[model samples]
Target: MTRDRFSYLAPWWLPGGNAQTIWAARAARRHFGPAPRWQRSRWDTPDGDFIDVDEALHASAPQAPLLVLFHGLEGSSASQYAVAFADFAAAHGLAYAVPHFRGCSGEINHAPRAYHSGDFSEIDWILRRFAHENPSRPLLAVGVSLGGNALMRWAGEMEQSATQLVCAIAAVSSPLDLAAGGYAIGRGFNRVVYTRMFMGTMVPKALQKLEQHPGLFKREALLAARDLYEFDNLFTAPLHGFRDTVDYWTRASAKPVLHRIRVPALALNARNDPFVPAASLPTLQDAGPSVTLWQPAHGGHVGFPVSHGPFGLPGHVRAMPEAVGNWLLAQL
Candidate 1:
């Protein structure tokens, strides 16, 4: 793995990590761009539940590389990063798809099990199916945040076999060490702001899941849960077959197994990312020869807003997707 100097820098106005992260995400959501005419497909799992995939098809480029995106915790196809990547795919004429994790695509999943960060079995099944269906097209996967960690785990688990399934893989702002990230997000300012925002949606969805399968977990405990660790322990960990949050986090983290990844892969994280700490990021010696670590100084979380030209005009919320897209294509 090469610890190359990343080429992304936030504008002068976006000073802190939290500021850069929040501002860029909001800005992207507000700005107008080409929204993909998404063709939604529901694929049934071996279990009774189903997963939804939103695709932007290109029949003209019959054998174009398929870009599969895996969204973060509580994220969907319409997520800011997901939409940005969809725009990039449309502009480049690449076939694109965003696979929503179980219970994440508006509809709650039928099974007792919900998605988690270390759910590589689900990732394996999804990617393998895509490979089988589009045998002619090279598969390239990009996962954001939670999804990224899960995808990296899948790559490591599959090892050399991963190369046959996908030509290249990229992860954006993934918390490689889930324990550190989980701890970080649950404390101080992150807890009050980010945790509250996530819980606003997650808690409701979890309750709905409980309604689907009565006696799943204790209702009072679930409601009392304040942060991710508490919430994961109350809902996510138990539902996903984990003993507790620590067990889930330890087993799910991608850092311990990063050296096992054999495919041409990129793990892009910002040194200033609020969710993922710079100390937790993997070094060149920590990864295999196939991995490249792009730890830029300014990009916060998945946010990579750029300032360009002489005047340093600051209107580039789409920079990370463009850079990631270019890197993925270069592997082919």
Candidate 2:
């Protein structure tokens, strides 16, 4: 409910919501820049699959605060936002690592199942292991889009149990209401552009998975899927043990569980976000005492383009990561 958490002003040239969101995903990669160096580690999951993590650290600060980053759907450590965040963490002397969701690490996973919006077990395993390995360092987390939804769900499920594991959490442009999000992205321009973009990669991946595990999925229905809703109903829901797309979206959404989150958490959603409708965003009252919902008038999806200086000197200033890093630093 408090509107004074952080101030974000979009760039002068980037005007509407679509422009800001599209440009960030399309044109802003080269401008925002990349991480200095990354150390890759693969962790084998108990379910016989693997999640790859790319770590970016300040060599001088061995015990600096650690941040566990979760990238969005179909996104990996190489994503523009992820790389930008890694750069920010490294420059600030914060040790950070991005854990790629199943089958998103540029390598095909072993299992037939892929990660969904609400799935958090893989992230939990990574965090628990990180906390165990580096007990001295402060732990914080940031999740983007789908990853953000999962982080919120995990925080809610863990409640006070997360206090020792993470000092605080931030969710940027998350689709907290999965049903609304799914419906929003299924219509008009979103269906033609965003849905196709997602399904383009997803269908092929599902086909590849089918090739490895014959007779495991309904190939005809999956191949016929034109949008996210159809894809979920045909593939994601069944593969994840949900009865249907409606059932999956209802249960997987982070909105229902936001009240249960016990950690100091920030959920930042752009009012103009193309994918997640502004109406779907949780209110401060719905989020309970521990969580804060900040809906800026601008900032499309994960895109928060600002003037320079925030991310060192001039050029493209990614506001979300800078805001998150500043908040985490304050919490620490």
lDDT of 2 at 241: 87
Clashes of each: 0, 0
> Model 1: per-residue lDDT, tens digit, 1-332?
66654687678877989988887777634223556678899999978789999887534287989999999989988888888888788778789999999989889989988899999999999999999999889999999999999999999999999998999999999999999899999989899999999999999988998898899999998899999999999888888888999999999999888999999999999998889888999988888888999988888888887665466654556788988999999999
lDDT of 2 by residue, 87-195 (tens): 7786677888888888898888889898999887766887899899878899999999999999999998888998879999999889999999899998998988899
Whole-model lDDT values for every prediction: 0.88, 0.83
Instruction: Single out the weakest 10-residue window by summed lDDT for candidate 1.
Output: 27-36
- TM-score of each candidate structure, all chains considered together: 0.96, 0.94
Winning candidate number (TM-score): 1
User: How many clashes would you count in candidate 2?
Assistant: 0
Model 1 gets an lDDT of 0.88
lDDT of 1 at 233: 90
Candidate 2 lDDT score relative to the true structure:
0.83
